[model samples]
Target: MAKIKEKLGRWLRVAIGGPMGIIAWGISGASAMAIVVWGLQTVALPLLMLKTASWGIWGLGVFRESRAKRENPPPKV
Candidate 1:
């Protein structure tokens, strides 16, 4: 019957569409989270490495200065 077919079609649409919509939304959200995480790491990792390298260079400079001063003492009066 026409009425029975219409009812069945509507039920099938709802049954498939509801879960498909939810799955699509979840996939979009997960992809967004992954992109955000990747972007943050891309920017932050370089800055952290630069800061550590600067600290290391500064420490080496200080060590060299101290050693130089010890090896060549100032002239006494």
Candidate 2:
């Protein structure tokens, strides 16, 4: 049980952290593009899509967490 819990915790952390890291990277990339390119029109759609994907990844993590909680519920105090 302890090992299972440890593995689950690591998985959850990765699931949540992956999207967050991607989102942060995307934000920085977009900012750099905006500053360097002098306009966002060219890369706007792609950047938007990247950000959207990050959100989707995050939603998946949330869904997984909720499902896990529903399946395993916390122990009583």
Candidate 3:
């Protein structure tokens, strides 16, 4: 269905865009901490791993919360 596809697209955009916006907007906290650690890491290996882990956690939380709100519409009679 077009509506379903649109909804999915919107969700994906949010998932991908959220972090980017956070970074662009200079939002801080855990993600900032991870980024600082990443930038300081001299070796590429652990940096990549931590980067993935941090983004994964961030994305998973945002996607889950977004999906829940999307899937559950308000009650109506």
Candidate 4:
């Protein structure tokens, strides 16, 4: 009788605890993912904008240089 009660208690604890543990684990994982995504967006967005602007400026410089060279060709060596 004592052994049966002990087994039943352990089974009840497992039945109650398993789903709760799973739920807690899922919430923690989702929270961690949200934090990581937020951090990446915060840090990456400005950097991406800066890089795009830099590329645009560089492209304009190249275009201007090409146009100038075409207008004033260097004397042939």
Q: Each candidate's root-mean-square deviation in Å? A: 33.2, 6.3, 6.9, 30.8
Tens digit per residue, CA lDDT, model 1, 1-77: 97679557655544333444345445445545655777756656554554455445445545554555568655664
lDDT string for model 2 (39-74, tens) is 677667776776677666566656666666668866
Backbone clashes under 3 angstroms, per model: 0, 0, 0, 0
Flag the better candidate by lDDT, 1 or 2. 2
By TM-score, the candidates rank as: 2, 1, 4, 3
What lDDT tens digits, residue by residue, belong to model 4 across residues 16-75? Answer: 334443454454455456557777566465545554554454455455544554686545
Please identify model 1 stretches exceeding 4 Å from their true place: 1-42
Write down the lDDT that model 2 would get. Answer: 0.64
Tell me the whole-model lDDT of each prediction, alpha carbons only.
0.53, 0.64, 0.58, 0.53
TM per prediction: 0.45, 0.48, 0.39, 0.42
Instruction: Kindly list the per-residue Cα lDDT of model 3 for residues 1-77, writing each as its tens digit.
Output: 97779768767756654555355334325445665776655535655665676566566657765776679853553
Best by lDDT: 2
